[model samples]
Target: MLSIEGLRVEVEGKEILKGLDLEVNAGEVHAIMGPNGSGKSTLAHVLAGREGYQISGGKLRYLGLDLQELEIEERAHAGIFLAMQYPVELPGVNNMIFLREALNAIRRARGEPEIDALGFMKQVRDKARELNLDEKLLKRSVNAGFSGGEKKRNEVLQMAMLAPKLAILDETDSGLDIDALRIVADGVNLLRSPERALILVTHYQRLLDYIQPDRVHVLAAGRIVRSGGRELALELEEKGYGWLSEEAAA
Candidate 1:
């Protein structure tokens, strides 16, 4: 579903992702784990078409189309979803309304009819309940006054509703406690399908324990230095990233 090859990216004048390469096919879950400043988030942001990042080199393609050619909204409309590490707050914007509009916008782009208010509400309520999200929060401004765990759940809620082809979650587990993490992971697991792929960018292996990945990649120094199965995550958890970083350097 997504192809990244020798992807080099720069923010301002400094390079971040240096010759990174990854391939995620449909029906696969890939976990990207790394320490601080390893360009894990940079890869996520670049794939999401966030501004301020310059693609200095390499190629990125999604569903066989050139990803760099698509604008941010276009990428979203094309079924690319990025659950950010920090979900922004929009004061005065009703969470329900924002989600409905966003979902309908994507639907319309795909030549599908917009979901009616009743259907949308039902869908929202069902997903909110599944995510253990307070129904009252849906009536409030998006992410406003939401706790860290609530914000992460809100991100998962959005992903569930959008049903994107490729979902990139950037540290959805960062601030979540065990219960919240399980709730969020369960919601993410429910979205898993043969037609949908997920790239989870995380710092620790705890998240992987809930949502088992088809492959675990260790990204250090802006590139994937090792790719292995779930055991790799266990190894990382036991041995930490120091060995991997040293190996990459060597």
Candidate 2:
């Protein structure tokens, strides 16, 4: 559903992605494993159309349209979702209100009718339950006073509610304990389907144990250097990225 070819991105004259190539088809989960500063987050931001990065060279095509032609919200309206590594805390905005507005905004963008208050509440609560989130948490300010795991689950809850065609998760497993990791993974697994695809960017292999990817990619030196199956994550865990860096250079 998403194709990125020869992507070269620069932020303030410094290049982060150099000829990075990746394609995520519908119904497939691809895990991008890389060490620090390997451009994993940069890739996610570029896909989401975040500002400040210039696409010096490349083509980003999503759902058959040139992604460069769409704005950030336009990309969201086009069914691209990014679950951030750090979910922001909104002081006055409740989670329920946040989600309803977001959902309706996308709907309006797509020329669909808005959901009423009652309908919106029910759907959010149901989705929250699906992610095992407490009903009261919905009433609280978005991510305010939430634990790390709760924040991650809330991200999943948003993904579940939005039901995007492509979801890019940038380190959703970061700072979560085992139980929370499993919960987040479970929520992600439930969303897998022939109509959807996921790009999971992570630094470790433990998350892969719960959510097995169809393909594994090693990102280093601003590009996807090597790719393999699920076993690739295991090998990276055993041998580390030093070997892959050598392979990539070779």
Candidate 3:
């Protein structure tokens, strides 16, 4: 569903992603594990079409279309969702209204009718419950007063509601405790389908234990230096990323 080849990205004249390459097909879950400053989040943001990052080299295609050509909203309408590492707070904006408008906009772009208020509320409530997110938070501003775990669950809630074709989750497990992690993972697992794909950018292997990835990649020095199966995550957990960095340097 997504193709990235030799992708080099720079922020403010400094390169973050250097010659990174990855391919994620439908029905596949890929985990990207790396230490600090390895450009994991850069890849996720670039895939989501976030601006300010100069694409210095290579191509990124989604569903056979050049992703760089699409605007951020266009990317979202095209079924690309990025659950950010830190979900921003939009004070004074009702969470439910924001979600409904966003979902309706995507639906409208797809030539589908907008969901009615009742339907939207029901769907949001159901999804919130599934994610173990407090229904009351929907009435508040988006992530305004939410705890770290709450914010992460809110991100997953958005993912569940949008039903994107390719979901890029950047550190969804970063601040979550075991309980919150399981709830978020279950929500993610529920969205898994033969036609959907997920790219999880994480620092720890614990997240992979809940949502088993088809492939695990060690990204160091801005490129994927090693790719393997679930066992790769286990090995990383046991050995850490030092070995991978040394190997990549060698």
Tens digit per residue, CA lDDT, model 3, 116-205: 999999999999998889999999999998999999999999999999999999999998889989999999999999999999999999
Q: Give the residue spans of candidate 1 off by over 4 A.
A: none
TM-score on alpha carbons, each prediction: 0.99, 0.98, 0.99
For TM-score, candidate 2 versus 3, the one ahead is 3
TM-score, ranked from best to worst: 1, 3, 2
Question: How many collisions between residues are there in candidate 3?
Answer: 0
Pairs that collide in candidate 3 are: none
Q: In candidate 1, which residue pairs get closer than 3 Å at backbone N, Cα or C atoms, i.e. clash? A: none
Alpha-carbon lDDT of model 1:
0.96
Clashing pairs in 2: none
Report the lDDT tens digits of candidate 2 across residue range 1-250. Answer: 8899999999999998999989899999999999998999999998999999999998899999999999999999999999999989999898888999999999999999999999988888888888889898999999999999999999999999888999999999999999999989999999999999999999999999999999999999899999999999999999999987888778
Candidate 3 local Cα displacement, residue 178, angstroms: 0.8
Which digits, one per residue and each the tens of the lDDT, describe model 1 over residues 1-250? 7889999999999998999989999999999999999999999999999999999999998999999999999999999999999999999999999999999999999999999999999999999999999999999999999999999999999999999999999999998999999999999999999999999999999999999999999999999999999999999999999999999999
Error of 3 at 149 (Å): 0.9
Candidate 3, position 49, lDDT: 85
- Two-way lDDT contest, 1 vs 2, winner: 1
Clashes of 2: 0
Residue 104 accuracy (lDDT) in model 3: 97
